[model samples]
Target: MTIGLDMMGGDFAPLEAVKGLQLYLSEPGAPANIFLLGDEAILRPLLATHMIPEDRIRVVHAPEVIGMHEHPTKALKEKQQSSIAVGFYLLSQGKIDAFISAGNTGAMLVGAHYSLKTIEGVMRPTISTIIPREDGRTGLLLDVGLNADCKPEHLNQFAVLGSLYARHILGIQQPRVGLINIGEEEGKGNILAQASYPLLKENNRIHFIGNVEGRDVLADKADVMVCEGFTGNIILKLAESFYEMTHRHSIRHEYLDRFNFEHYGGTPVLGINKPVIIGHGISRAPAFKNMLKLAAKMVKSDLFDQMQIAFRN
Candidate 1:
């Protein structure tokens, strides 16, 4: 499998991205070939410095770069030669099995939507974060920052998507799906939640548990938590702050350390035709390495094919 990396996307740009490639290469049994997308002049020297095997790495020169603050749709349209755009083009053309970037997230989303498009039955594509549970196990949360506003049908689909990801990517079997709400009781949330509960319950594709309250997010109450992007994004940001707060106070603990976004590398834009991972803007070398690892797993799992089958059935 070939995985594409946007060498110029993140805040650190080519340097950190090249460092990430070094880290990934150093790992034992690292799967998939890497296609680095960026300026050839910069990347070539970095690759030589890092000693990445030429056979395992391919460089695609894209001189243009979409800035972090640029509008997603506009940048993609105007900057056809940009790294992000080139990455998407390669992905759409099947030259790469997955595309990853720590740079402009909006551009990645816009590229995925317009270039590869969504799965046939998917109403809208969703992005999800890996939730580090209080226990040793991990969970999945969906619509983290995509589709802030959603319908009941959208939540139901998110449950399916999140569940498949949990099972295939996260190695959770029969992952339990939960609707995030204010209370655990059945009729407890707004119209969306109330409307979504039955769909989740009746859907045989996933193991749907009852409503999961805020307190349950860190616990094992649910393996896959589904919510609109607005609530999920708030929860995500709040969770991120916990790690920052702990660092500020110089408190070190195993559980708290799991909150580091770098550990997971990036969040994958689920429901797209191909795997597209969006890394944090401030992602460093370790984060990039993890993103590639995750991308490799997603491609190996045939995740999008599974989604198409699930949605079709």
Candidate 2:
């Protein structure tokens, strides 16, 4: 399958993204097609510099680079040649099965939302994050950084998506889902969580685990955790710092390394009609490669099709 990789748009730019590509291409069975978007002039030389196989990679020249600070909606419309926009355009045109970028997240989200669009009946697309659990497995968290303010219906949809993701990628059967709230009590969180609780409980599709607090996440209390973007993003960022701290304190324990985002490659943008994976801003080649690998699996699993069925019912 064709997997589009955005060579630009990250904090480390083309260099790290190239490294990720190399890692993927070096695998025994690399993707059939690797469409790299960004300035071909800058990207081609880098491939040659690393002595990577040029024939395996396709370069699409995207001259305009969207700054991290630029507004997503404005940049997408004005900067037609920007890496994020180009990636989205190619995805929409069916030139690629999936798209991965380590660029400006807001711009990427905005571009992907408008260009590729979301599944019908999907309130909004959430960037789902998965963190390796202490038990040698992983759990799913949604709205990582996509939508801050959400309604009860939005949270309900996220639960469905998160559960399906866990079951497919993480190998969790009948994944137990929960709402990230202030307290474990049924009536704990604000109006949103309180309102969403009943909907999730009523829905027999998922294994509802009532309310799950932030601290209980690593305890394996829930397989799928749902929250608004504001809450989920904060939890994700804080976990990053904590994971780094644990690594520095004792490098001997190999388990601490499992918490890294590089292993998962990147977050998957849910609710989109087509699969679009968003990498970390500072992602490199290995990370990008992993992102594409994840995308390919999503396609093989028919994730979007499954989502259509899940939401349709």
Candidate 3:
């Protein structure tokens, strides 16, 4: 399987992307077929300087890069040679089976959604990435920024989609789905969360665990956590901050290594017609390459078609 990576999409650009690529290569059983998309003029020397094998990696020269400051829609429309844009086009054309980008999040979202389109009947695509929890098990959070507002039906579909992801990726047959809310009680949330609970419960497509509070996210009450993009993003930010703050005292300790968000690589923009994974803009080479392995794993596991049917039902 081929994973097309946008080398110029993030804060560190090609350098950090090279780190992630190294991680992917070092991983046992990782895919070696990678298409690096960015300016070859700068990248070639970096590869030479690092003594990275030229035969194992391929470079697709893309001149322009979609800057973080550029509007997503406008850049996607006008920047034909943009790294992210061209990488996504390669994804659509099947020259590359999956795509990994650490560039502009908004541009990645916009490009992936419209370029690949959503699965039939999916209103908005989501970013589902695995997060380390306190209880030794990880959790899945969706709509991390894909849709600010969601209806009962959309949340219900997210539940199904997330469950399928958990099952396939986490290897859970009956992954519990939770609706994020202010309280766990029935009808204890805002109009959106309250309304989503009933539909989630009624849906036989997934195993709904009713409502779970943001505090329970790290506690591992449910395997697949569901919330609107606005709420989910806030929760993710807070959890990340808390994790880092709590680990501040043990920064030098090897035994007490805190969970690093970078270790999980990137979040796949779920529901896209093809696999499109988005890494943190600040991602270095290690995280970037793991994101490529993830896309390979997704294609290998057939999560796209599985989710397409899971929600279709």
Candidate 3 ranges with C-alpha deviation above 4 Å: 246-258
Stretches off by above 4 angstroms in model 1 are none
Residue lDDT tens for model 3, 263-305: 7788988776787888887787668766887788888886878
Any residue pairs clashing in model 3, and if so which? 9-103, 16-284, 16-285, 19-285, 19-286, 20-285, 20-286, 20-289
Clashes of each: 1, 7, 8
TM-score of 3: 0.94
Q: After superposition, how far is residue 166 of candidate 2 from its true place, in Å?
A: 1.5
Worst 10 residues of 3 by lDDT: 250-259
Give the clash count for model 2. 7
- Per-candidate TM-scores read 0.98, 0.95, 0.94
**Ten consecutive residues with minimal summed lDDT in candidate 2?**
244-253
Query: Residues 126-167, candidate 2, lDDT per residue (tens digit)?
Result: 888996788877889988877899999899999999988888
Quote the positional error of residue 196 for candidate 2 in Å: 1.4
Better of 2 and 3 by lDDT: 2
